[model samples]
Target: MTDTDIGYRATRRTVLPASLRLRYRLTPWWVKVIVVYLLARLASTVMLVALASVQGANPWTGAHPGYFDYASIWDGRWYDIVAEAGYPKSLPIGADGTVQQNAWAFLPAYPFLARAVMTVTFLPWSPAAVLVSFGFGLGAALVFYRLMALRLPGSTSLFATVIFCAGPTSPLFQLAYAESMYLFFLMLALYLLLKRRYWWMLAPVLVMAFTRPSGLAFALAMGFHVVYRWVVRRRDEFPVRERVASIVVMLVAGVSGIAWPAIAGLVTGVPDAYTATELSWRADYIGHVHLVPFAPWIQAADWWFGLFLQTSPWLGYITLVTVLALFGIWMFAPSVRRLGVDLRFWSVAYALYLLAVFFPQSSTFRLLAPMSPLAGAIAQPKSRTYRVVIVVLCLALQWGWLLVCWGVDGLDWSPP
Candidate 1:
């Protein structure tokens, strides 16, 4: 017991880790979000490289062969095209007399921003796309964490953010995909609504409408909230100006959601140009115009049921059972209630919208990214052990999903 032990203890107390802890204590919440997002991006990058390095995997290539090639596939390829060449003047008709897949089906917001960054900074398209996503994605994380903290304690909010970053499909945020950009706008719009800044929500709503198809979900939620306040609540509790602001938010959002497709149609001189191009990706590639209400659900049921039935009829039955189980979870889970009315309804409506319009393909996970707000339910549980277990399980599923969906040849069957 002596001078030697005292000297060792004294030296250890002034280590780099301890100093860094002191700095972290002084750091702001937004900076912590950036750090977490960057770390998550690093982890996802490692996973991507490992998956791509597997022997016999299809090269994610068209004009080039490398990581960027993988990043520029499926919807990403369309976005890259729009960024580089810009949209076409007319619909490219196929030999079968139906519309072919073209840039019109894709939205312009992310591509335009990426293009602008490329022009200003001289980065290549791939790097520019990544930069846009990484920057916007970090911003979205900041707002999302703030919103969560508003509803829950700081510790729980931070925990939920970690779980979200480590989610099975969150790798989309790391890629040069538009979901991250779309998420930034969505979160901003929601934050504006939360802060009671109805007017400020307009800009994000318009941008979000051009970013992804889910913009309407936000508009619907805003409109619903407005109606709920005026009709469901006491008349004396509302003000005329607030009601007018609410209506403006609703109308502006609703119009913004439809503006792009309508523009495509007007520019092309084909009323259904946008719808036709979108439907060109379906199972029946040249199906009719956009799906009517409930059609996507029917198509999804038929498609999944038939797919599973090929292996065994019982498997088809199991598919229905799985759906019923999910429905039960949606209806009964505490997470649903914990998200509050706006986010909960938005998640459910957005999920339904995706099911209706999008094929139940591999990229369905990415399409559902807007429902991230629902993940707030994860923060409701008080047990630290439970949160840890959930994060571990999510990461494990993420790795497995990467291996199964990405580590293979003929990768076109699944969208990235």
Candidate 2:
């Protein structure tokens, strides 16, 4: 029998019925992507539980509750406050209603959603945070998987999803922080844009505007994609009318992302209200040295490069080698270079923008997290021994970083 006939016989002889076998045989590619994404997310949840146990805390309680008992949970407290009440304004001024601080300074999307969920379901914000965390993490994985499958085959795409879920940065997904949500929106926007679903892409881009100031990156990347298509395809995929509408949509998303903080600054009569707070914190904790002429660019580069040393010293050393390897790969691998208007350029650009804007916070590395998919797409072994060594070293370094951060307790929930 031919391969097709032999495969059919094997399926019939298997325990699964013919209908079930056919169903599995014909499972849609996207459904398989979702399954892999969910499995990776479930694995991440298990890792979180294990991390919490090692830290002598209950992962189920999460960061907010853990904060009450441990000072390490300070970052979780900010998210809690943002979730429960809107951002806090400064206390009451004189009877004349003078404002002291702008509570509205905090971005509204995450906290607003958190509060809405609590109001509707009577679920505490802590558990709600966890639920949102899980949802966003899974959503991000699914989007990333789809994005990878656009450029990679099934096995490579699945491996990329796993790496994203279990990489050293995975702990961020378990925290009350906004990385999970930010990445989810980002990946969704990218996926929709790749699929040429411009209108659907606009919705997530709009929501992303409220998630973080960095949401603008999504719109900008989409704009780049449009320009790329115009140049290369010459196909009126986005007609003149649609293109005009998309421009308007991008403007709205970009403005809304920075609206709250901008408004807070105006209300408080301090142009640098939020920026000052972040700068002060960075200087005090991270020893950030401001540079002249190109302060933002310098800070951004410092931040990206700093990730190797700041997060985990051991990982830092491993990352040094990994960086070298990456540089070599990028130089030599024509396939990776030709992957085209996908994540590689977008991620590097976003990372640059984040670094320039945020002054090199260690968390900035997470902005490049999407590159993990690209990494998996290009991962191949020229020789058996070489593949085994690289895989073991990379996984070991990633796990070691995860363990150290988890053992220290509450790294994600609180600021460094």
lDDT, candidate 2, 365-409, per-residue tens: 554564554665444324557555654554565456555543445
Query: What's the lDDT for residue 256 in model 2?
Result: 67
Q: What is the per-residue lDDT of model 1 for residues 229-249, given as tens digits with 9 covering 90 to 100?
A: 777557546678778887899
Leading candidate by TM-score:
1
Q: How many residue pairs clash (N, CA or C atoms closer than 3 angstroms) in each of the candidate models, in the order given?
A: 0, 5
For model 2, the stretches where C-alpha displacement exceeds 4 angstroms are 1-46, 54-74, 91-106, 233-238, 285-333, 370-376, 379-398, 406-416
Superposed Cα deviation of residue 226, candidate 1 (Å): 1.4
For candidate 1, the 10 contiguous residues with the lowest summed lDDT are 55-64
What TM-score, computed on C-alpha atoms, does each candidate reach? 0.87, 0.71
Candidate 1, residue 61: how far the Cα is off, in Å: 1.9
Q: In candidate 2, which residue pairs get closer than 3 Å at backbone N, Cα or C atoms, i.e. clash? A: 75-414, 88-103, 89-103, 300-355, 303-360
